[model samples]
Target: MQALFILSVWTSLVALGCLAPFVLALAYVWVDLFRPHDVAPALGQLFPFSLTTAVLTLGAYVLVDRRDPPRLGLLTALLIIWAGWITLTTTWALYPTAAWAKWDWAFKTILFSTLLPFFFRSRIQIEAALLVILCCIASNVVCFAIKSVLASGGYGRPLGLIQINAGWGGEGSTLGTYAFACLPLVAFLQRHSIVAPSRGWLRWVYFAAPVIAVIGAFGTFARAALVACVVWAALLWWRSRHKFMVAIMLVAGAAAVVPLMGDAWKARISTSFAPRQDESANTRLLVWEWTIGLANQYPAGAGFNGYLGNRFVTQDEWGEDNVQEGRAFHSIYFEVLGEHGWVGLAIFLATFAVFFLNMRSVRRAARARPELEWIGDLARALSHGVLIFMAGAAFVGIAFYPLHYYLLALAVSTSAALHRATLSSADRAPQESLADLAVGHNAARLPAWRQRAGQTKASI
Candidate 1:
């Protein structure tokens, strides 16, 4: 049934793409996020779903969609360089098989993200793209939340759609991080979304989404999610006009949710504060340390899956030497440093920095313009989402994930929209001023003309 439904949706969207090319773009994002093939193996055997969607999306863009090239800003440039650097590093990667496997999808993610701003130029297009992403993510989030509420989810449990506890969606920590990161976007969409209808019970679904995302994040029992929640709250409070009310609500919400958390969840989260006490946390610390040493030894980096070569020793609680080999970096920063080297890490950081600046630029440009307020608000939401993701990424190795790249693309699109709007307004300003001046000049002659007509009427 699931397979039939998914196929129906995919076919419908593909057909719709002929009339509206942006629909194809949305279809691609849907396939990427939902991974319908993974959900049903029978579907996978039929054809390559992801590759087909990508090809269709690109074809639609070239053949049907209007080509409005995005401004090649610092962010885009940085992303391009970053992509190139990672590819170059892959050539020297110690683990060639693993490196190439990662590079295949990673490069595609970068390329698509770079092209996203071009496809979504207008407010409606941009909002629709975000809505599609949120909905896809919510599918997993809703399921995870329901299971958590019913079973009181535990650490290492697979609460999402996929049973395997690996990759972005299946992994608890990464899923939890994504859940928190999406809160800001959810809030933005609820208020300003043009694509979503304002009337009916559908509107309330937006309200429920954030709550479900929170539950799902808690359900994962990930310390990274806890940290992301804190950062998300702080960013929300900072952006909110009613800081006091937001603070109160934050505190009250936390109070309400805390009691619902299981003992296992509390214990796992507590380990974050005292890293040495927990074996996992201790291992992460060791991995990060090893990454730093590796960075110094090989400044050029060991490329993707470089951690496979990592070997470290640690003393157990019993004071016995234990050897740990082939452990993952577990940190995005270390993952990049280990895989792509210092140069790639620099490019990665610069790209995000540029994204933040772009959002700031949009906010400042849209500040006083009431018509552009939605753009400003969206920019804030994207920035907050990015900030939360960055906080989460400190603990999770998601440097090359599609989520962050999507957020970055949205930021760029918002900034680009702001610039185009500003320029159009500027072009109209002179014409409007001249029309006002001509109206005033005509009004100034009207009284004398009326007096002359009155004198002529009296003489007649």
Candidate 2:
């Protein structure tokens, strides 16, 4: 894998030169998520992929792009504020050493999040990023499936039993959360490709992506993922123009898979309703309650990565499960509350609030432009994915996850680009073909305004 990373780096530099750093940065983002460590161990540890790529991308953007600097959106501003607040709170953190380390990791995540909008200038660039991330996810899914097959039918259990990492690769619930968040993007791309026509191979790959993603989510055996996937699928089906066909496909897919699911999967899902019987559910509830207690006690905040160690000492007095190592904040809301206190939590929520609002504006702007119909579709898909993250994060510890912020950055860029497109088109309306541009007619027609205006005056 190290050799592959080396080859990839060399190839990018040779083929793309100035643009290579930014491309590698985006590649790093995807590779980091997939974490193909088994295939490439050195790639996992040797390179600081995201940070290095981000610095290189920033340099390239400044020197070569020659365009206006990317505008920082409301979400980005809030994130900056939130990061600063987290850093400030680290000074008084219960565990200062751990706090600083946690702060560094988080700073890196926010750094790349801030850079993405600047890098993604056009609709094609945005689509490329989405496709790349989806393909990375698909690769992870395929790997998990391969692992499960080799392990001889353990797909019904927590994936961690076979693959014991965390984040995208390890934790079943985390992987499930990722799959759920990405399902909308895959579906949107697939639908758009079919309607507008794209490369045949690319369209087929998009078409199969959602299915592979669904399989990946199911393999996780994560209840939150299951719920989120079901909700995401419904939203996609409703938003799709071919509702009946989508419905039939969905039903047929379910029919083929249902009989194959074992009792273990059924039992695992059933635990969602009967939480009393589920040890994991009980532990999660205990963790959430402990987090709430911690928030109330330490109104200022526990600081970054101050949970487990502090919990060990404080849990005996305040927690229900005094002996158990309290899991890190399971819910994003609770996570923020516990780690950052009221002010941090408020900023965190506000960031997403502004992000969703921006997406709405993007969709509205796209609705106004016939040439940018895909922008409207993408905006909706992004919104749905955001909703899924918000919902799924109730069960997953994704308060600091890069994917959510990455999507927010894209939303910011999409809205900004669409706004610019609308303004530019309006500015050019007097010279462009007015009738063809109006009422959602063909956008390819050239301007005939001068001749038409002259003929109209003559007729009058």
Candidate 3:
């Protein structure tokens, strides 16, 4: 029954995409984030949902939605270069089989990201994309948040929609990271949403979504989530117009929530401050050390899944030595460094830096226009979300995850939209001014002509 329902919904979305090509883009995002195939086993076996949507979306873009293509900017160029570099590195991967498997998805993610701006060219299209992403994220985290309240969450516990701890939705740390990172977008929707009517029930849903997301983050029992929350809060306060009030609210909210934290949650978060005390934290340190050593041996990177060959030793609290092998690189920086080498890592970092600058430029340009204030707000929200993700990614290996790439694509789309809107406005301003001047000139002559007529009649 669930499978049938999901298939029906997917079919309906595809039907809508036939009329509006951009709907295909949103449908693609929905498939990526929700992973409905994973939710329903029958659906998974029947066909590849993500692949189907990707093909449909690309086809629509080429056949119908090619009217206004986005400008090929520096950010897109960097991503293309980055993608090419990673593909080259795959030839020398320590684990060729594993590398190829990862490359299959990672390359697609980069390619899709670059093309996203082309599909979403307008403000409404961009906002709709954001809303879909937010809702998909919420669908996973909101459930986890409810479970956390009913049953106090523990580290390594399966608390999300899925019972596995693998992908973004299944993994505790990654899920929590995404939950907090998405908070800013939630706030953006509440204030500037055009898709959802700004009146009654939907407004309340927007108001409660962030609170639920925070709870879901706590439910993961991930120290990374806690750190991300603090970083996001600080960034939020810094960006707020009423800084003092925001600070006060933050403090009051923390005070209210702190008492509800379970002992397991408290214990897990405290370990973040003292890494040496926790086994997981200690393992991350060992993995990072191994990655650095690998980078020294292969400065150009060993390719994707290079960490598969990692071998290291760690000393326990009791002074016992334990050997670890094939441990994952927990940090995004190290993940790229180990897999792609230093050069790849440099390219990856450069891509991120360029993205941040793009968002900054958009915000600055949009803020000056009263009508485009929503664009400025969207840019701010995206930047904040990216920052939060970066903070959390310090301890998680999601370098190739769909979430960050999607955010980058949204940023690009936003920058492009601002550029187009600004140009359109600039083109109209001169014509409008000239029209106003002509009207004033006609009005000024009308009274003088009427007086001349009256004097002619008096002379007669």
Candidate 4:
């Protein structure tokens, strides 16, 4: 009891530490997804801890100490606009209540994402942010691994687990998406460690973290996530300066995981090719077909939870007996289209396009400058993660997922910082050169004048 009391006291102190807000943000992301109430009921009960910390941090940022103005870019502007549009759509939505609920969630996500850029100013802070995310995912991996072990009696899951819980009553696919997004950050940390000798500890995490993440993704038996992993791995290999080494690592990793993938797992993934046989796949197709019909009929859109109301209406009018009930928009593109209309979808796509283009440019800029290479590597990883999400979105609904916007903010902020650094360096260069020239001129005159003085004295 004494030990427990002491431990509780220590925990409280840690929570109240100077860096508590950042830590709380990570904890919020984890608990929001994992819902580890059984593991730590105290923390679990404090479910709103993350949001509370975020609000507190924002207050601190504004009032506690005067800080520089936040670095806002195209992505930030677009995100705010996107949030406003989402709110506007709620008014015209088929179900205002449902739309309002979604709007509330989106508002929180956008607010948190917008606040992220302000927190990350230095490389260490950025890396720390990356670490926070990695740790959150790691918690999920550990939880899932334990569940798999218990379910399989330590032999391991033969077909992988189905619908691993990821807090807020979410499913394995959601966890898989989270893992997929984070993989690139893991790679970035690893690469950063190699480039910067100071972060030597990350090298170990680099090797271990990816394997765990892969396991976590596979455990979910999420085919889309697995596909994303393949794409990511390929991209990583292509970007690697050491192709041979990366290839060897990939081969070795595959060899290790192949034995663990039993026939059931193999068969499940193979269904990706023969999606018709899968009930889920068949339903998705029908949903998509229904979506197209609705899109044509209502070009303006249904507005927030519009699919539910529109689906019933469409069926009665179009009167298709074979059509399934209107389901959640499985695809992000389709979701935005259904809720916000073609105009919303266009803006959504445009936002992503602009954000990605900026990242690519940042990558090129970082690569060109040796000092900013870390930022470049980060850009590359973020862009790859975004691509994975883009493809993964077709399989699942995550249009308003916080991670997506957070990553965009990350990319934009990192790019802005790099440019600012470059400009600062450029500004200092001419001043430095002028100083050097003046010093040289003074030295030359001193020697000549000294010689003249000596000659004059000798002649006298």
Q: How many residue pairs clash in each candidate?
A: 0, 3, 2, 2
Candidate 2 whole-model C-alpha lDDT, 0 to 1: 0.70
Clashes of 2: 3
Kindly list the per-residue Cα lDDT of model 2 for residues 1-460, writing each as its tens digit. 5468654753464246354435654665664555444335566477555555556666777777647446776778887888788887888888788788878877777767777777677766677778767666665666555555455224334343224555655666767777778878876777664333446677677666666666677766678777787788788688779999999988898888655656777777888997755666767776777877888888878888656743432232244453556467777888788888888888888988888888887787778667888888888888999888888778877787777878887887788788778778888886566654572343234367855665588799
| Whole-model lDDT values for every prediction | 0.86, 0.70, 0.87, 0.67
lDDT per residue as tens, model 1, 220-290: 88888888889988988887899999999999999999888967888888898899988789989989988
Model 1 stretches astray by more than 4 angstroms: 314-322, 444-460
- Name the 10 consecutive residues with the lowest summed lDDT in model 2: 310-319
Clash pairs of candidate 1? Answer: none
Q: Which scores better on lDDT, 1 or 4?
A: 1
Q: Candidate 4 regions off by >4 Å?
A: 1-47, 149-170, 193-202, 242-252, 309-326, 448-460
Q: How far is candidate 3 from the true structure (C-alpha RMSD, Å)?
A: 3.9
Ranking by lDDT: 3, 1, 2, 4
- TM-score of every candidate relative to the true structure: 0.94, 0.83, 0.94, 0.82
